[model samples]
Target: MLSFNTTIRKIHLWLGLTCGLIASFSGLTGSLYVWQPEITAALNPELLKVENVENIKEVTILKSVVSLIETHKDSLNKIFLPYREQQTIAIQFKNGKTNYYHPVTSEFLGEKSASISFFENLLNLHRTLGIPQIGKYIIGTSAIIFFIILITSGVYIWWKAYANNLKKGFKVKWKAKKKKFNFDLHKALGIYFFIPLIIIAFTGSYFTYNAVYKSALKVFDNPNTHLINQQKNKNFSTLNETLLNSNEKYALRAIYFPKDKSGMYRIRYIKDRFIKAGYRKTKEVEINEKGDITTLSDFRFDSNSNRIVAQFYPIHIGEIAGICGRILVFISGMVPLVLLITGFRIYRLKKNKGLKKK
Candidate 1:
């Protein structure tokens, strides 16, 4: 019978091999996705950005939306306001068509389907492996298993090295034999990148298992009071006035127009001027046809649970720590691939020794 320590070691080895490829793929894709915004801007310069635009007037944005409304009518689902001076306004239709217009001149730049974008497909693969119905569940399960492997491997590493030499566990033996060097490299990389790997896996899982997250929020007394108004669509003549009034108080980011008659107009923005527009800093509000604005959700005034939930995205994507955080996350995403290679080398070394003994 195998000893308990040996059993755990075997478990760790097997688990890592089982899902190592998937984890590595996820890491590589996630690393590329870290720079997606910049890459996308570079790829679609003319469609996403404009020239000779100094400042965008509020009335220009209003007229642009009204024009789009007149053209698309009730088919319009959402309008993404330009976040920067040169960026164009983006509108999404209910049929999944997205179009961009100049924020200053309201000139039609281009349109594309989300289904065809390379980055969109990359995101889909990261989340669901490009599989349709059950892809998310598969990815979610792999994340759970990957998380377990981290814990188990961490414990095994500590168990083996703590009593002997904790310092040696963290350092790779460059002067040692190939096998010893591979083993040390694996251990060191795993230890150094463990926290980031754990964070990425946990947050990725959080998105997939959102139902459980919502349930946990309920336990933490999150009110979740942002229900749809369910009223019929009224004249949108007051929309421009409502937007202008809100813009005076908040830095508007995006506006999600009502889907149908029952849907309310949802506005996402940041209240503090000093705070950069990010998932953590953003707040939301809903506007009824009567033009009454209601606070949807603000993490600052929300329950601790809600605040924690708000941090997940930024933390996962490394936006919370800014550029430095992004760099760290990008490197962390590559660590899994390194670990897999070193781990396989170590396994092969051990297997050959066992065969020789037999």
Candidate 2:
């Protein structure tokens, strides 16, 4: 019978071979997603940034934006008003085309291609490879197995090395010969980053299999929650305008207009300033056309479980600490790819040596 350590090594080897391709693809895409906010801002500044916040127009411009929607006529869906001074007005069409305009001038900046937006496409690729439902399950199952491999393999390697010698386990010999160097990279770097790698795997899993995450939330007794208003929809757009004008603390990110007469409009926003709270400290308001505010939800006021669930996005993308956090996440995203390469090298070298000896 195989020894316990030998069996673990075989499992680790096979698991890496089976899942390494998907993991590498995920890491590469996730690295790009880590800089999503900055990329969008940099690529489309005219639509994403304002030159003069001081000369900003009044709420009447919303009416003007609404008028522009008439150009789309029957095809027009709804206009999105961003609270940030730099953000341009977004006009979405029922046909799925999106156009950007200057919030102040209403100048038609450009239209988003139906093919896909850069970050949005990248996000879909990372999450579901642009194939929902089935793709999500595939990625989620792979992520769970990846998580297990990380734990079992990482602990086994660390324990084996320490059993051999303390320094050998903890230190990588920079000046070592090529094979030794590769071996150290696989083991030492893996040990150093084990915890963070586990976190990345878990958060990726949570995003891919949200039902599993929701089920976990039940342990905290935080049931799924949403706002429900008894009143009917009446002039919901005007009500949203009123709310936007009244609030200055939160910056409106997006607005989902009521679909039918009975539907409620959902407005989502982020706190204006903070290192950790920009994404985590979000608020939403659901209002009907009747000008009745039905539901108001804020992360700050959420339960511990709800709040924990809310942090998943920020944590996954390293948005928790702003720029510095993104850098950490970017580097971590590269780790899985690195491990795949180095681990394969070690396996091949050992295999060849054993074959030659035979």
Candidate 3:
């Protein structure tokens, strides 16, 4: 019978082979997604940027929303407030299309372009392998395997090195043969980049198993926290008034106009710092046409689990630390592919040597 260490090595090798393709795909696409915001801005500068930003003032939120409704004849699903003067407000419609308007001029630029469509497809492919519900579970399961391999193999590598010579664990034998070099590169890179790689795997798993994360949050957050208010009236003008009367400055992120008599206007916004800073703080206000604040959710006062859940996406994509964080995540995504190649080669060489000895 194989020893415990031998069994774990087999498990790690097989797991890596099984999930290698999908995991590599996720890493490659995730690297691209890290710069999605920048790519979007570059692809559609006319829609995303503006000139004379200094001279431009904030447009009336209610007026712009009303104009969108009158022109499109579609219920306003949400309004994305620009984080910067050069950025444009995105008015999302019930039809699942978003129209970009100059925040200063309120000039209609255009709908989402092919580039945005391509990016969306890329995201879906990354998350679901271009497959829907079933693919998500597969990815989630693979993520768990990744975490297990990281823990088991990582400890084993260091422990075995320590048993041989304590210093061997830290030093790469550059003058060694091809196989030794490969082994050193794999072990060294794994140790050096372990933290970020583990983070990416854990968070990416959360995205794949979001239902599990949501259920876990129920233990901390009030069960009724997500339930929508039933008292909806079409008096959004009053809702707008209440927002205007508030002393605090807020940049709108999204506004959900009531769909029926029972639907409430759910407004999500941010205050303090640009939205590009991952909007570390956010406030969600749900109110009826009567202008009564029916429900208020603020990240500042949220429970610990709630806060973690809210920050999960930003943390996963490295938006929390801005450009530097994104670059780290992008590089981390590529490490697994390197490990897979080196690891498989090592396994093949070991298997051939064992056969020769037999």
Query: Evaluated with lDDT, which candidate comes out highest?
Result: 1
Alpha carbon lDDT of each predicted model: 0.74, 0.70, 0.72
Candidate 1 achieves a global lDDT of: 0.74
Q: What's the residue-level lDDT of 189 in candidate 1?
A: 84
TM value for model 3: 0.83
How well does candidate 2 match the true structure in TM-score terms? 0.83
- Cα RMSDs of all predictions? 4.1, 3.9, 4.0
Candidate 3: give its CA RMSD in angstroms: 4.0
Worst 10 residues of 1 by lDDT: 227-236
Worst 10 residues of 3 by lDDT: 227-236
Question: Candidate 3: which pairs clash?
Answer: none
On a 0 to 1 TM-score scale, where does candidate 1 land against the true structure? 0.84
* Model 3 stretches with alpha carbons more than 4 Å out: 52-63, 73-75, 83-86, 163-167, 173-176, 214-239, 242-249, 258-261, 272-279
Clashes of each: 0, 7, 0
**Residue 13 accuracy (lDDT) in model 1:** 81
Once all C-alphas are superposed, what RMSD does model 2 give against the true structure? Answer: 3.9
